[model samples]
Target: MHVKDVMTTRVVRISPDNSVRQAARMMFDNNVSGVPVVDDQGQLVGIISEGDLIRRTELCSGTPSPADTGLAPDEIAAAYVKRCSWRVGDAMTPDPVSIDEDASVTRAARIMHERGIKRLPVLRNGELVGIISRWDLLQAVLSARQDDLPAGDDAIRRSVLARLGDNTGLEGLNVTATVSDGIVHLWGNVETAGCRRAARLLAENVRGVRGVVEHFPDPYPR
Candidate 1:
């Protein structure tokens, strides 16, 4: 499914000029971890999240001095602004990662996994159209329809044999099957007990299959 198919169109946004306190309150009230930071023209500028808010001066006891960490003067100054700044523009993370609205759900999930992020802003033509979260992907999985399996004894027998020959580890193992009244009889020259078990399972999982009976020569026959 495409990201547009599952993404949330009703996104809560924040302005860069807004107070940091406002951003925090918005997140709390909306039950969201973050919100996209937009500019005057409604262009996405950055994003403010719980991670960013946690670094604020109000939450910490004190800021580490540059001399203690041996940080460059500019780096220390930037860190100070992030911790003490009141404006969301100064505290939010800039140039946040985003995904296109037309992108596949799989791509969105992959990007989230690789970046260790929980959500992504969905854009279209440089405009924020929606947002996709890990929860949306999970909902998609739960709502997806199950595939219709083959019906009837003949069809089930065909499916089992086809699966066994198609990269099912039993390929070219002299395996074969027949069906009678939804019951399957597996006949083959499987070398290992595992192979015999695999054949039985393959047949059992086929649609319309009621039971499986294996008819194979014992490898340990003396």
Candidate 2:
């Protein structure tokens, strides 16, 4: 699926000229952790999030000095501005990462994971069309339909064997499966208890599977 399929069209935005207090209130009232900062022409300029606001001087007792942080004078000054600035423009994260509306949901998720971000502003032709968050991706997962599997004991056995061989952690192990009356019987020389359990689960999850029986030799044989 694509990002546009799950993105939220109603985005709560804030102006760069808005006060820090206003930005905080907007987030609180909207029940959001961040707001996209826009310019007079409705162009996305930056983003202010709870992470940015938590560093404000009002929330802290004191700011760290350059000597304590071992940071350069300019770096310390920039951090000071982020912590003490009144305008959202100076405090917000500039040139924030964004995703195209037509991009795949997998790509969007990868970007968010790599950047350690919770949301991305979905843009169309360099203009903000909507926003996609981790929550939205989760909703898509919850609504997705499971792949239809073929019925019958033979199909179930094939599926179980294929699953075991297809990166199910039982790969390379001497595992075999037989199905009768929709019940699967797994046999193999799996050394680890985890792999044995994995084989059982792999068979149990296949469609038309009613029960799973393991016939592997005990690891702690006397």
Q: Which candidate number has the best TM-score?
A: 2
User: What do the candidate models score in CA lDDT, each in turn?
Assistant: 0.88, 0.88
- Please write out the lDDT profile of model 1 over residues 91-116, one tens digit for every residue: 99999999999899989998999999
Q: Quote model 1's TM-score.
A: 0.67
How far is 23's C-alpha from truth in model 1 (Å)?
0.4
**Per-prediction TM-score:** 0.67, 0.67
How many clashing residue pairs appear in each of the predictions shown? Answer: 0, 0
- lDDT measured at residue 10 in model 1 versus the true structure, 0 to 100: 97
Candidate 1 runs further than 4 Å off: 65-68, 147-222
RMSD of 2: 4.8
**Which is the leading candidate under lDDT?**
1
